[model samples]
Target chain A: MTNIEINTYLTFGYLLWIIAYLVAFVAFRDRARSGAIFRAALIVLLCIHTGSIVLRWVESYQMGIGHAPLSNLYESLVFFSWSVALALIVVWRRFGTDLVALLGVPIVFLILASTFLIDPNIRPLIPALQSNWLVAHVFTCFLGYAGFAVSFVAALLLLVARSSAKAAELLPGKKLLDEIVYRSILIGFPLLTLGIITGAAWAEHAWGTYWSWDPKETWSLVTWLVYAGFLHARLSRGWSGGRTALLSVVGFCAVMFTYFGVNYLPGLHSYF
Target chain B: MKKSKTMETGSSESVSILFQIKAFFTSVRTTVFLLFTIALGAILGTVVPQGEPLEHIAMSGNTFLYRLALILDINNIFRSWWFTSLLGLLTLNILGCLFQRVPSIWQDLRGRNPKTSFKLHFRSSLTIAQLKDRLVPVGQEIMRAAPVISGTRDTQHYSWVKGRIYLIGFPLIHIGIIVILLGSVIGAFWGYKGHMMIAEGDSSNKFALIPSGEARTLPFTITVDGFKLVKYPTGEPKEFRSNVRLTQDGKDMLTGSILVNHPLTYEGISLFQADYKVLGVKDVKLSFKTKEGEDLVKVADPRHDIDIPGTDVKLKTLSLDPGTIAQGPGIQVSVPGKSDKPQLVSIYQKDKRPLNIDGVEIRFLGFTPLYATGLQIGYDPGVRIVWLGCTMLVLGFILTLFTNLQKLSIELGGSSKGTDVAISGRSRKLRKEFRQKVEGAFAGITELRRET
Candidate 1:
């Protein structure tokens, strides 16, 4: 499909998801009365998301040398949010919605916005990226990033829950938000780790040395450290809720730098 | 024997000292601080040109600032001691954090319920009194409840439920963190990196090693057999590539065309196609002298005076540098012992003019263009550790998110009218969701009881 066609589908999916989210938020007023409507809207948005992804996949195939729609910045953001959507649905199903979705939706929107900064022309990857590890690395990393985004938002909500007694009435209290945030980071961290590992392996294959301290690589390390701190903070008794959430926010900013700022940075990583 | 014993004792003392040092490094705060500093250094490195000589920045701007930047090695941050130490500190911090935290987490995971507060609470979960209501006698029942729904207090009608696969998730988290640290550390310690500029038709693997103190060397020879720049109609490069080979024992080990990003690798070493430069056809040249009978010598270069072993005839170029005068592309030629105003012999792109040096003669050789291909060379031993660290970190994170110790306990006392249900829950990390799950579980129970 052409860029216009793909974007049209994407825009439609984006609208559908937003509508579903709003429906769910409004439906929460009387949950019993709104279950059917919420489920229906959610199903529509999810189905639309799946369809859009499939179409994108098909579009790549039509270009002859098929790609995973993740070779560039815009594609990465879109894919990231898509993974978040799918994973969030699974989380909602297995764990039941306890206002975690509230934390998840904004992340989806942010990822969508990231697409604007990224070039959406669907260009081929450089010769350096023509390795088996590229798929494994990007897939796992973006998925991990999406998971972290969810956790970050959840962590924010957790602080909100803790700060105000009024927040306790809204599905998740501070404790629940903390757990969800921790859980999100837990899932995201491993994926990030996998992503980094795969990237290193690929780097070794392509650049001879695995760690080059490239801006992208360094920022990735920075991202890892913040999450590591978050995990370690648990042992010290007081790095949870707001502080942990704040750290997570900082990590995502690092993530953005690694992904986008590297190109602008005066380093070998600028090529990527 | 006494000397041996003393040696052992001294060794043990040193070992103890080492252990103390290791212990100090393993602290959480140290790791955090290390990460912070490394992050700061990395930010600096990104903002500045890593490993670039000050000449580069000076080539671009102000003398004072350039000199200062040069002094600070801002252009060469990654390889500098201060920056490297920050990285080392970051690695140490990770090790330290693991050293201090893993054991405790493991103990928490391994610590069995030895009639402790946890066991007491576990027993107080909602299965005991409810069992009496069911047909299964409180003492002996035929069926057991689901895992998520089984617990009892220390009353006479209670039974301890062993639902702890979920409780055993902390190790996975710890293991993941450790693995990630291992990967990064391995990468840091075990890798080597360098760069080379291989010209077309060049065979020597004399890679121009980057100045990295002690850790540098080429394990094998990489030859640039040839390079071609295929251009578009617009004169832009459509594709540029170099024929490359890794050779050993006079045998080619690997051969391929390396283009942008498509590097060639031998064993574990890879040569990246980093960059290329245009040459001004002066790198190699051919020279000839019309001898007594034949075009005796098609000398590759005139710098090396070729002696026919037994003949007194020898030819040498007086000048070998980029010599192209306004009128003629000529080199000042000379003969041994009898140098009379060294012959100014002109050479052309294609040999056209012959040198008439009174009685001597010279011919223009073909031009050799200076072709330089930039190759990035690297070897890293710490990469595997880095990869391992990444794995651990990833697994730890996933476990933290996907799994949790979900526990709910309630003690019900018969009050002749109805039973009182006290509900409470505890989770290791994410308390918020744990509370909600417990509350939801209670609500579900209330709904079930009401329906019944």
Candidate 2:
């Protein structure tokens, strides 16, 4: 089957996974059992998702225009969904809770479903994207973005817990949610740094200017700075529970701007 | 005595102000505040166009906003005085924090008696010697290091500490960021960026600096031998390459090709394939058939007139079209008659019917587009320093994220029940897992293990 068709099917699988998680949440008293059910189904679905991405790569080579499936908007959205789901599973395993995934999986489903709106044909790579560094830069940035996406979900839940006692009871404790926000940033910040570094190296080779202060480059820096402030506030100032959660939300807004909003501006960093 | 007391009070007041200044720079609040302010400035820079001239803003017809932009230097926010000062303040804050944390980092690295996070007590049937043999390996395996045996035979003690390298994580990461910034500053001062456009089969040693059209001469000459644009079957550009020859004093030093993402460097100045422009038609191929049924073909320069051999007819190309009219690629050629006016004829490439001029048929063939390759010249000596700092930053993250420093202090003593075992430990990560492993190692001691 085609990759887009497989992605469409996987979107439904994620929806089913979310439904099963909700059912287990209300029905089963044992949290671990519910987490196990959600985790097992998501893993099988991700395996198929991974296979489809590989198949897309093979299909491109067969078409005599071989390139990694990360050169345009449609492919980036697909990969981004995969990364979000993978990152959510990692967080669930590390923290031993599926509450964050309850919110994160829907984001994955939305991103996957949105791929149908754009063209998904495997086109040849443009001249500017003909470097191996393009692969490295995109891979690191999206993984870091996935980490931030999970952090945003946890932070949003923390904020919601503050206002509603019902959410407070249904969600994990305030401390665990706070820890999730911090720990996800801890994983994301370094990867984002590496992404920017690789992009600079690629720019120096292709454009002869490493830091051009382009709109996209400036936005990425803005995102980095916001997260840097979040880290300092949480680690050094000992700020948490509410204030740090707010900062995580702001930082993810910057991430979204850097990903989607920068395309509206004129800059060297276009495409996806 | 009263005058002397007033003088002493004044001196103490001055000392207090200086102490407050030190406290301000070293505070984490200052770091967070500065980070947010810089981010705000960058956001403004992106929203408003950056690197544009003040005159351009002045022409925007909003006098109040233009004046505000002028006062704040928002036309180029990144390089404005305020933004650079913010960066400088952040660097100082990092240095202050680094200096304040060094003593503690050194203390941890020295393997001093660290604070224990938890303690466990157990009563065992074995002697102190038997306890040491079994528990020593567990400590060794967990910490990945041998213990320092310290107590007497009655009360045996084993203390294990590992991951001393983790102590440098904080310093390395912060210092690496400072280094990257410093490298960029050095590049801003010492390096140059510019572009050079050279047509195919042309040589140039001069380039224009970016954003300022000032000329600068290179030490060596660059001759573009050829430029090619390869397109995919769908008409999208696939690759651009420029074959160049580097010459010094008329002697060829090197000959190579530069493609996108692949630059050519000579004498520390690298040239990247930035862009390309089609200047004009290079040459056109044309085929002519005389009325005597003899076929003749000649490659003619579009800029010059072509004279028919053994005839007084001359053909001059007015324009060349690349299949604009569905009749395929055609060229407008003017054939001058014996009168004062010239007759224009349209000839299409690969057409079965050719244009006739004075009993001779002329068919237009394809023409090559002359391209000028734009090469970006860069000379940055600080790029290596920036790369070094990036490596250190990545290494620091690896050490901080993957490694966990753990310390174990175990003391075993003889008791009335059998033996009294006291185990206390501390870990930076996975405290519960570490506790479980320590307890599982001593579970053989039987039903008396408890947290203290």
Candidate 3:
């Protein structure tokens, strides 16, 4: 299929995810058969989403530009939504439940919607971006972002489930929710560290400086410090429950700012 | 006796002072506070335009805010005294925290038993005779299941600990951070960065500093032999390379080429191809045709005069424009004998542009573009140390995040019916998961007991 057709398929996949999540939420509330149907549909949509991304990459090759579909804002957002979907599937399969998917679905939808708002046209790579490091850097960074997104959703659920009995009944136990948040951070932190290191290596090659204290770099460091604080407090201070949840939420906010807000500030990384 | 008493008091007073100082820096609360403050400063640095001149910031129309920024050194916050002091304080705090915790962590690792408050009671039974044979096999199984540090056997008990060695990764990570900070300090004091632009076939031994623009001469001279710019079919730049030769004491030292993302290093100095610029025409070949059906060709140098073969009209080359929208070169020429004003004449390599100057027709033939390569030169003695620290930091993170300290204790008591086995364990991280594994091991041991 053409790239445009692939994009259409992706849009359809996101819609299907939302619908399936709604079904799963209902199933969670009422203990109905819809949960099984939702699970089947989710698997189907994930396959289609993965195919769409692969097709986009193929289309780039056919056009002879021949880069991964991850060099621009539009492609990164689409990749991000796909990552969130993959994380949701993994969390669901590992936990044997779709409770967290109720929170995950909306985030993927929002990001996919934002993707549509930006340009999706495939462009040739600039000389600065024409390196193998681009693939490693962007892929690892987005995966880290996806992990934090999942953790944010889990943290939000933890806060809500702890306060309201109705929410608690519909969700997993508070302990499990906390565990999910911590697990997600455990997955993201190392990936983020790798991403930063790869970016530094790339910078050394492209700009002759390993670290320039650019706005994007500084902001990434800030995000790292915030999460480091969270992990430190949890591991050493024995912090858990609401305080850890709050830290996760705050950490994700910092992540969002580093990803989106830094674009407006003038820096060397403005090529987003 | 009086003097000894005085000395004791003095020593005690000094000891208390040291205790208070260590207590202040070793507090976890101080660490969290320092992290918060550093993060805040970094945010401010990113939000405000940094490294700009004071006058330029003042011209942005917020006089009071600019003054306040100047007072707070926000214009260069990353290198400002306060920010640097905060970093220094953080390094000290980490060192202090490591000092205080090392003793305790060492003590915990050395202690034989788990630090749990739970107590175990042992009793003998009929299967006490089989316990001796089962003890070795059970201990082996536990060691195989996890990373066991040590195993001990008693008459009725078998115990082993796994991953206790990984506890050192925590302190190693803190030490790595300090190493990184030290590297930064060394870089700040000793490193230098400068920029130099060398035209093709030119040489220079001096460059201007990046911040202050002060020219500094190096002990060696660098010569640019050639500069090449390659473009894609789309007319976008693909690569820029500069061939350079270094000379020390008027003798050839090294010859190499620097490209984008590739650099040349010699004698602890590195040169990077940061940018390039095209100069005016080097030489131009022009053909002039007279109305008498005769051809006159002359090669003209830019900024030089050329005489027409059959007329008093003199063609003087003024300047050349590397065509922006049109891909060919355009030459500006002046007819000194005919018109005093210089006229811009377009030239194309494929399609010739004929200009009639005072009734003498001149066709532009060919042109060459000269370029200069801009190089960013840096000398940093601390870069290797920084890279080493980075490597250590990643390794420490991997060890600390992925591994945990675990200890498992099994107490087997022989009862009148059979042997009753109780298994309990503790983990530094992921305790719940460790407990489940211990329970699984316990079930396996029970199955073995029945089989035997």
Per lDDT, the best of the predicted structures is 2
DockQ for every prediction shown: 0.27, 0.81, 0.58
**Model 1 lDDT per residue over B1-452, tens place:** 99999999999999999988886687666666666666777677777656666777788777776875766667777767787676556556655666666666565456433222221212123354563343123212211343223344443323323334444345555555556555555555665567777777677655555565444447677788877766544454545578888888888788898776466767766677777886544333444443453454453454467443225566665554344543335445555444554444445433455654334455555445456787877555555555555555555455555555444444444443344444444555455655555444444333124211
Model 2 agreement with the true structure over B340-442: per-residue lDDT tens digits: 6888877778677887777888887788889999999999988878888888898998998988888898888887778788888988777878888887776
Q: B297, model 1: CA deviation in Å? A: 34
Runs of candidate 1 with Cα error greater than 4 angstroms are A1-6, A16-29, A94-110, A113-119, A159-171, A260-264, A268-272, B1-41, B48-117, B121-191, B197-202, B211-220, B223-245, B252-268, B276-374, B388-452
Model 2 chain B: weakest 10-residue lDDT segment is B443-452
Off by over 4 Å in 2: A19-35, A266-268, B59-61, B121-127, B152-155, B288-297, B303-314, B322-329, B336-341, B350-352, B358-361, B412-421, B447-451
Stronger candidate by TM-score (1 vs 3):
3
Q: What RMSD value applies to candidate 3? A: 4.6
Residue A4's C-alpha lDDT in candidate 3?
53
Q: Give the TM-score of candidate 1.
A: 0.63
Among all windows of ten consecutive residues in candidate 1 chain A, which has the lowest summed lDDT?
A: A32-41
Q: How does chain B score by TM in each prediction?
A: 0.53, 0.89, 0.78
TM-score of each prediction: 0.63, 0.93, 0.86
Superposed Cα deviation of residue B208, candidate 3 (Å): 0.4
Clashing pairs in 2: none
Candidate 2 positional error at A36, Å: 3.7
